[model samples]
Target: MMYTEENKKEVILFGYGKFGRHMYHHLSQGGHHVKLATMVESNYEEASADRIKDIKRFNPKHNDSIRMLGINPAKHLLYCAMEHTSNNLFLVLSLRELYHDAMIVAISNSEENTRKLKYAGADTVIDIYEASAQHLVTNLTKPAVAEAISTIFFEKNNLKIAEILLESDTLLEGKHAAEIDFYGRGLILVAVIDREMGDELIYLSRGVDHKFDAGDTLVLAGKADDILSFKMELAGV
Candidate 1:
């Protein structure tokens, strides 16, 4: 996918590493200026050109690069490269003084880095390892849950995980989410049923005491076994 000049917001990528190239092309094809920066442009060659296009290069080590190019407001979305997994907080924070309202997406190889990035004021800190691992697990084991889950790029491995339908004879039928603790027992309850207005996913523990209807479903999380056990318990299996 390539952007042929039709998008609105200009996007700037902080590095030309693998993640940078992926983010650049993904955003570019979706329509953005997609200025890709790196210590050198040679890293982004024809071999990887298919994944990137019209990338503006810069030197990562040059202070002038940060002064002139690293923090430009011309771009609306700035995706920091995550593949390098180095001191990205400093690089990302340096841009804040330059582009105040720019939407910054920081990618980290670990949860610690992700937390650091968030602490440093990145718009969103994405966990690259978490995203990759989840995708691998879901794709390899349960391809059925790919779309039901939110994009790993945005979520911290805890999005709308799994959806389940409840039967009338379930033990957890007339239960409230707050009554049961899913904080560490594995899995969290995101929504429950109202049983009337067509899939009205009411937030758990917010004071909706409606009993479980036959067609009602309870969405939950954790491992596949936990999810299934939750469903069976609710379905009276």
Candidate 2:
């Protein structure tokens, strides 16, 4: 997907480990401005030339070094996916302290660390193991649902998963999910993650008419171009 300057989001990724690398690949492929930051020297040598060019080395222990990156607290989306839980926790803490309003997403290895990361000021904490286990269980018990997700996310290269952030006074705010013509825009409303609902994903496939609100994340699935066009239209750009 090609994002115009008006709508492109800046993504700053800390660590170049498995999860970090995966995030970089997808975000870059989607045409977002992504910067990969790492403290380990070997990670630079291991990363590809394209990624290495954008990689910035910084000392994770120092607040000054992190601030040197010049991250825009209001605009840049930060991801802390260091291989070690302690590193991720420290990074999240430092980032929260530096940019109190910034959105920090961290990956945790266990439920215990998920709580720690959240307490450390991460806005979103993704438990990798828990997510994996859930996917495994879903595949085993809900084969049809699993197959459908796999087909949309993995099997179809043209399809993309988009997280549309709703802002105050936006066009869709206060509207019901059923009232929107998503299919006309060539998109599917997969789910809605509302902040008021403790960030729980309310799947639309259940036929629930969810009322839109600011801070709600609409998860949509569709062709990349169609998704981007619809996003621009929603933003009135």
Candidate 3:
């Protein structure tokens, strides 16, 4: 799905430890309404005496779009960044029991826990170590590309990378990637995930032609507005 400012998700983070704290800062700075959800609210004060001040402090580096939220079951997206994999799994399970439709993204520090987290009802499981190694590799081998990626991720801008799955009735079905003219529409078609090919996504830069099919997820990087518009166009919504 597209990730524009208007469509930015309201996320409830399940921990406030090192990883949780950093995630809170980054996502809030990125203009997402994020709330810290602990087993107890006082954990905030225990974790950081200046937690409230820090949360309320407006970073001059970021725009006024940064937002914070309280625990609300209505909030649809949950990010489980607990320090322990077991805790993360339990938290995901509990949240799943509460919000059946909630979109859960759980962080896994171990390979074994990754599958467990997914089976526990997390829609997506992120491996911290794997991601860190990938990031390090990118920085070491492709500094320029890494810098550009950092600008999109760390800095506040209209640019964003999003993955959108095409449904059976999508307007773009049956078309080739070259026929879509993504650049003309202000988007860079980065890759296409082929569902029928055992989850192997074809990157446009690989010099391979693709026939757009239903259930194929298109990964695109572009300005938030453009990305949202593209998603809408494909969905014919």
Point to the candidate with the largest TM-score. 2
Ranking by TM-score: 2, 3, 1
In angstroms, how far off is 220's CA in candidate 2? 4.1
**Would you list the C-alpha lDDT of every candidate in the order shown?**
0.64, 0.85, 0.74
Off by over 4 Å in 2: 1-8, 48-51, 154-156, 161-237
Query: What residue runs in model 1 are displaced by over 4 Å at the alpha carbon?
Result: 1-8, 44-53, 60-63, 70-75, 139-142, 147-237
lDDT of 1 by residue, 1-237 (tens): 121233347767777667776776666556566676665446656325566554555554455766666455654577788356554666677666556777778988878888888877688887877988988898878876774554422343433256666666665556755566666557876787666767567876677655566667666656555665565666566
Worst 10 residues of 3 by lDDT: 57-66
Q: Is candidate 1 or candidate 2 better by lDDT?
A: 2
How close to the true structure is residue 190 of candidate 3, measured as C-alpha lDDT? 87
Q: Which residue pairs overlap in candidate 1's backbone?
A: 39-60, 170-234
Q: Residues 82-176, candidate 2, lDDT per residue (tens digit)?
A: 88898889999999998989999999989899999999999899899898898899999999999877877666367767788898887899999
Candidate 2: worst-modelled 10 consecutive residues by lDDT: 1-10
Per-residue lDDT, model 2, residue 176, is 95
- CA lDDT for candidate 2: 0.85
TM-score of each: 0.52, 0.74, 0.69
